[model samples]
Target: MSASETTSRRQVGWGIVLMLGASVCYALMGVSVKIAGRDLPLLTLLLGRSAMLVVASFLLLKFRGSPARPGNPRLILGRSATGFVAMGFYYYAITQIPLANAVTLQFMSPLFVAFFSAKLLGERVGTTLLLCIVLAGIGATLVVAPDLSTFGGDSLFALAAAVLAGVAYVMVRELRKTDTPETIVFNFAVFSLVFSSPAVFLLDRVPTPVEFAALVGTGLFAFGGQILMTYSYRLLEVAFASVFSYSTVLFSALFGFVALGEQPTLLAALGAALIVGTGVIVSVAERVPPAP
Candidate 1:
């Protein structure tokens, strides 16, 4: 095989490993938060998590000596805004929805990313990839559809969270086009901290030693998840990396069952499969070059 082909295969291998590790750790974060909820209020725990992320990301950046790249300040600020909002929904959604379900819907963000990319970045959408998106959306809807009736109040919030995450994912595509990963992550933590501070002031109580430990545990898992995610993105195409990313849902489902006693139904399993399958197809299809 040519060098390029060899590199592509290696990238895929790395992507698989990174996605699996990241996904499992991310699922654990969800489970941890659920456990922490037993004693702490949602807002209080969220603020604590945000604070931890800020500290962890800052130390990470400092350790690596990551310097911010010069870019459009407007775009950076926009991303920073959305990033904070996205995490708001993310934390809230997990609290409301089953861990597996919330995570599965979030993974569908790449479909929105590709769609937005075509609109915002003017990237061409091949027919195959378009179909893949449709399939993925259908799968995601299927997974969450049953909860619509029983989960009325939560349904809207989860949908909103999923949509917000999609927007954040799309924005990241643009941000990465002009910035480094460390820069993006660093700014994400900064803005998340800034945005969460007010809520922290109003909602947070000083955590006990055990409560403090739970916060640290969740933050560490999230930090590892982010690191694995960033490393996967660096190793593989985001499109390709997205396929492996579905592994997060798989992991989350397991964690939900263990942590929250939210066992998967047959339909939910099937839905997860279809959604993740569609994502894989989208990734591989996007790999194909357009016909001249």
Candidate 2:
């Protein structure tokens, strides 16, 4: 009835659409990683990704006239270090496991965030939060059931990526108080590039044109997804917008099926549902106001 209400609804609509687009971009990025990894070493792929991110993030900071240096160097470096290692684990998982399975396991970040936030941020974790964490743990186990018998499986890498990603996110929460997102991203990109550049000397062969394109696509799609997801949060509440992020799991499954001819087993499908459902509950619960 009111103009404000009408505008609010429209913004939410746009936010959902943008978030869905972001999910698709992320899924495509995973597919691209799989394609590129087939021909290149993991370190080579990381080098290419870091280079693209450095270029893209540098240009974005310049366009926004943001500072290149971080306000809190120690925290920024910690976040960047964790993020870089997590990315390496995630990329390795993508090459070794099914795309959907890898994405599902990595999505466990939010559950790990709960644990880290309680310990590091002094945030209280209630009964529901604890229960959600247990459910998510079980869900993750189911997703990786097939590989559990193998020591040091790729699924473990995905789970490790999730844990480190959670730590990086918690650090980002602290960094948000002092630095802009653009500055944080630029710093991380630079950190990744500087640390990963050594891989260039280790490369055994140059990538073919098709492999090169896939490597480039990995960064382009990931950056696009990050930009779109960030803007969507501006339009919608973080809790509501985050639900749309689970769509990335669905998109990854679809892309894996179509692009890579991969399919999820029945148990993995059930596990993915549990993880996505618990993730949505945890995200929404965190945003709810405490009872009076």
Candidate 3:
């Protein structure tokens, strides 16, 4: 292979690894949310998580000597606004639905990313890539099997979260053109903290010691996941990188089972299998240069 092609393959390889690492962190964050959701108000949980990110991102930028300001303030603000709202919907859905189900629903963001990346970023969406998206979508649907009566309002919130997340991911790709990952993350955390602060007064109960740990864990894990995801998306084509996001659904299923004592139905298990299988295919296929 040519040198550029070889470098592209390597980037794709590391992107897949980083995206999977992100999935693990995100899944763990969900576990923390599940544990703390009982006592924490939606806004309150967000407040703690955002606050943690603010501190973590600041330290990271300072340690690296990276600029804290985003290169494109407009794009950063738009990204943060969409992400903040998506998170609100996500927290509400997670509280109301099974953790795995809520995550699977939000997994729809990859489909949105694929389309938006193609339309907005002008990224290549060849036949193979489109098939990967379709396969992943099928897997996600099987995992969630969402129905009107069963999921109700939570389903609506989940869908809204997915749409908003889609927009946010597109903004990430856009920002990557001119901004460092730390800048994007720090700005997002700043916006989240500002937007979520007003909801702190809605706290239902003060958290116990264990609950406090869970709250902190949510922020820590989420920050790690966001950092990994930012780098992964920056390194790979948005469409290709997004296909690996299906890994989050698999991890969410595993965490939901162990932490929440939720058993996956046979169909859901099959769905998870489909998700993992497609992820492998996409990862391997991406290494090969597209026929010119």
The candidate that achieves the highest TM-score relative to the unseen native structure: 3
lDDT of each: 0.66, 0.75, 0.85
lDDT, candidate 1, 1-292, per-residue tens: 8987767766666666886798888788877776676667666666677777778877877788877553656777787677567666666777776665667666666666666666776656667666766676666556656564555566456566656665665566566657665677767767766766675556546777876787787877877886677666556544445555656666776677776677677776786788677756655556642111
- Model 2, position 139, has a per-residue lDDT of 68
Cα displacement (Å) at residue 146, model 1: 5.1
Model 3: per-residue Cα lDDT over 63-91, one tens digit each: 87879977899999999999999988998
lDDT of 1: 0.66
Off by over 4 Å in 1: 68-70, 141-146, 203-205, 208-210, 234-240, 279-292
- Name the runs in model 2 displaced over 4 angstroms: 1-23, 124-152, 227-246, 264-292
RMSD of 2: 4.4
Question: Which regions of candidate 3 fall more than 4 Å away from where they truly are?
Answer: 146-149, 287-292
Q: TM-score ranking from best to worst? A: 3, 1, 2
Candidate 3 weakest ten by summed lDDT: 283-292
TM-score, each model? 0.82, 0.78, 0.94
Spell out the clash pairs found in candidate 2. Answer: none
Positional deviation of residue 139's Cα in model 3 after best superposition, in angstroms: 1.2
